[model samples]
Target: MILILGGTTEGRIAASIVDEGEKTFYYSTKGNEQEIALKHGVRLAGALDKKELIRFCREKEIRLIIDAAHPFAKELHDTVYYAADELNTPVIRYERIYPKLDTDVDGIFQHLDYDGVMSSLREDKVRRLLTLTGVKSIAKLKPYWKEKGVQCYCRILDRDSSRELALKEEFPEENLVYDTPDESLDELLKRLRPEAVLIKESGISGGFLEKTAIIRQNKIPIYLVNRPQLKPSARTVDGEYGLRATIDEFLPQFFPLHTGISTGTCATAAARFAYAKILSPSPYVFIDKERIPVILPGGETIPVQIHSFSGSFSLRRIEATVSVRKNGGSDPDVTHGMLISATVSIEWDHTKEMRLLKEGELPEIIFHAGEGVGTVTLPGLGLEVGGPAINATPRKMIRENFEAVIERACVPIYSTPIHVTISVEGGKEIAARTFNPRLGIEGGISIIGTSGIVRPFSSEAFVNAIRKEMEVAQATGAPRIVINSGAKSERMVRNQYPDLPPQAFVHYGNFIGETIQIASELGIERVTLGVMIGKAVKLAEGHLDTHSKQVTMNREFLATLAHEAGCSDETVSAITQLTLARELWTLLTPSELTAFTSLLISRCAQHCQPLLPNGELTVLLISEEGVIYG
Candidate 1:
């Protein structure tokens, strides 16, 4: 068994990765301990305080403990070291990986503490200081303002919570700059040339290396404050490196192993249940709840919704109450069993929406509930309730994809769920680019996934979600919209329309029918579909099932196209699905390939007309011959 001393983002992320079948416990701080563990469905072994941790180790038979707590979580890190020694257990320090120095400038220095950092700077020469040390330590340097006579600035998370902290700490509002690594620091420095820059080693998040490099390029000195040293006996690793490396090594067991409860499997099951049955009907209910009224294909039942039937029937529903429980918690005093009763109403009817719903086996929902026991439950037939609120995964995926496209996308992400909550910014432009507006999911993007598993090479789910984006864009009065297949295409699309609202773009993988249907539904005026060759061809041929799992290269179709283009039959049949277009180009010279692309684009325009009868459709064939027939 492993107990992770978690608190920081890296710690939560690491804990989130903890798999079942392996004995692992996440020890959080007093208040957040239960919440963090529950969020990831990892066992919470109470705090990392000596007594609770030691007691938990002995009781749970914890063989190894991971100190993946915050870098500045000094006391907990120390306690784990001492407890491990006392219990004679292996203690691994899962450290955060910090970015290396990527700057070409000179005169930038790194130090161990604030005083050392302050002493090294050019006291009289420094005109402005950019502090990237977050908001916690802003007060420490305020006293120096009178003596140094240098204007100090700090970059922090652009959150209202962070803002509240800044106001409480009396941080200078003018100097309270927001942190964005991609933002042009050169422009910033040019506007306000500082003599020195003060910063903390905030690992990768602080953008330490990039910030330093930017400051150094302007001939400014950087006052790098080193992390504080823990106790000699504290279990330590190479900060972020150790944490990430350990998770990478141990995470596979949770997914593939059969022993112990598997969080991934459980979450996968839950997600499948939600998607297959719950998402369309009772999308409101969660894991650990009882007596959920969920509508299915036929009649409704107060019990459960069943997708598959073992009897001689097409599909069936049962009216039954469901209960959830947990096992193998750190607490030795209480026996584990069902923790909550969730009643679900399952019914069946032949609604077109029900028949057209996405179908696949669901993923399991796993989490640690009250105490340290892990819980895995599938709500395919019913509603699930209990466990900590986990809405960060969807947020992360959304932010990552959005930031990748916008280059400077800065939206505040809440670790918790905010249903019906309003996000003024996320609601404005970016939401139009997403499906949130259509789904009636207000505020920022929804934290999603039942099992927390992303299928390999599958874009069906993502594409299906774009219909919602179209609805949102239409509702927001976006006349001209750009739809791309993935992140790279979205980035390129954004570059093409720099002034367009971020919401005016959508990432629709291969669900050509769904996206176009949304366009038709919304009565869109114009649509620019950016596609890779394979998907465009699928769309050109009117294949609704564009999923890689469902469709493959039609050798006959390719051969026909090849023959029509005067290419050898062997050329079309021999090529892999992914490289078919490029391989088709190989049969012809450069000019012919360009002509073929144009032909494909022209065919695409013809094919899309049926999908968008009254609306204008522009097919942008993105390949070696950039923007072929837009």
Candidate 2:
């Protein structure tokens, strides 16, 4: 058994690349590790201390350990190293990929240490400091900025805590401390022009490329921070080559009986196989109508229809002008119907078998594992089911049309039938983001029409979805509803309640009161509210509606707390308004953080109790202390 300590994306990807047959374990400090692990069919272990780590490994009978923990998680890394040394198990620390600065930017400066950064900033004019750095480093800059009296603006993550931090710091309410870049940098520059920009070399997905574009457009001096270098003792790999080489080298060691097992070659061979099947001469027509038969590889059959197709090749640009007629006539005037021209696209992976779903006119490729297979539909070709439901009908027919013709068949017809991917010319790029992340639904949005017709509003559908999800959660035998605004809390909640399935936890997303009410209505016997500090204060103040628009900084209440604690109004307001419960604790010395966390937890408990008077309520507040209440 392989125990893989994974916190970073690289670790996840590395784990994903491991042999399909190997039993792999992926561990995370935060709670969502289980869902992720389950999705990929990997064994998951929650955040564990040094002793717990040893016990877990020994009990699980783990043979090898892979420490793919975040570069910054030194304690966890040390624990893994120590655990391996004691258990006498070999450990491989998968090195994380860091952002490599482009050679074009000349005046950009890079720093390793925070103190060094402070000193370096002090040397320059440093006016209008745009800390593209994370919120974790904000406190360090606060003391310096307070003394220096320099105008500083930090671009933190556009999260609730970051927003609250900005509000607490009194960093110009109108000029946001952090923002998501939907608009171009040129537009953003016009909004908040800065002389200098400080940014971390966060990898590709971290929006470093966009940051560079913004910086270059504005021609602002940049203070770039480099990632911590790996220790010399650790084995390392370059981008794709390292990952490929490691798997190749390790595969033979483990599977000596298996020959010709190259990861790259396998992927290529698989791609070829999928392509060959798609290009092969086969029956591609559907005969569903009686008496009058219509062949539709393109369009011109059904009136007002939805065609769903799935294949290896891209069909994003394969637009078909569809014309539909009633029964047996092609008279446009007699048909009295609608015409739709739409792009046909397919989502198929080379690694999986053909599993097509035929629901009326729509044909979808049912994904088994990571692969998609050819599944085509002609929306205009009215099938045996007659005219599809008005809402069930697609506006157009979309079928994958491969741009390239393959002459050579690499694999034999019976050689385990390796699947190959269809190279849909423009299909892949068009579906880049939608196909990869978010919405557990992978590949792309299913070409589905439930109502048969597109309606003006979809709010009722959303409510129905939530209701169904709630019912599903309740069915899982989770008595206590765990509603969290953060992903981490839900994970921790699951760890605490191993019997309770993950779906039971609802991500309320700033709808604390609404979630509570829903749980109460749904007959949830109890509820555990998990929240960070930013939302805690409002909850304490009986501002049940914690929406920022509904909440005003209760200056008087904060002033009173400050006076009771013997602090200034500014100090108290700042402390009270802090989104981070940990930071609020910092205002009070070492002894004070707990007191502060406790006070806030009490406030939250008091505010929450009456909302769900019938249910047993437990508000678990997580601050720097970690889980102050239960």
Q: Specify the highest-lDDT model's number.
A: 1
Put down candidate 2 lDDT per residue, 195-239, tens digits, no spaces.
Answer: 787777665645677777778768888877676664454344423
RMSD of 1: 23.0
Candidate 2 worst ten-residue window by lDDT: 326-335
The sequence of per-residue lDDT tens digits that candidate 1 reaches over residues 15-114 is: 5435322333545543432233232234444445688778878988876676766666566777878888899886666555465443333455777777
Per-candidate local distance difference test: 0.49, 0.48
Q: How many residue pairs clash in each candidate?
A: 60, 20
**Model 2 / residue 283 / CA error / Å:** 63
Q: How far in Å is the alpha carbon of 531 misplaced in model 2?
A: 48
Q: Candidate 1's error at 104, in angstroms?
A: 5.8
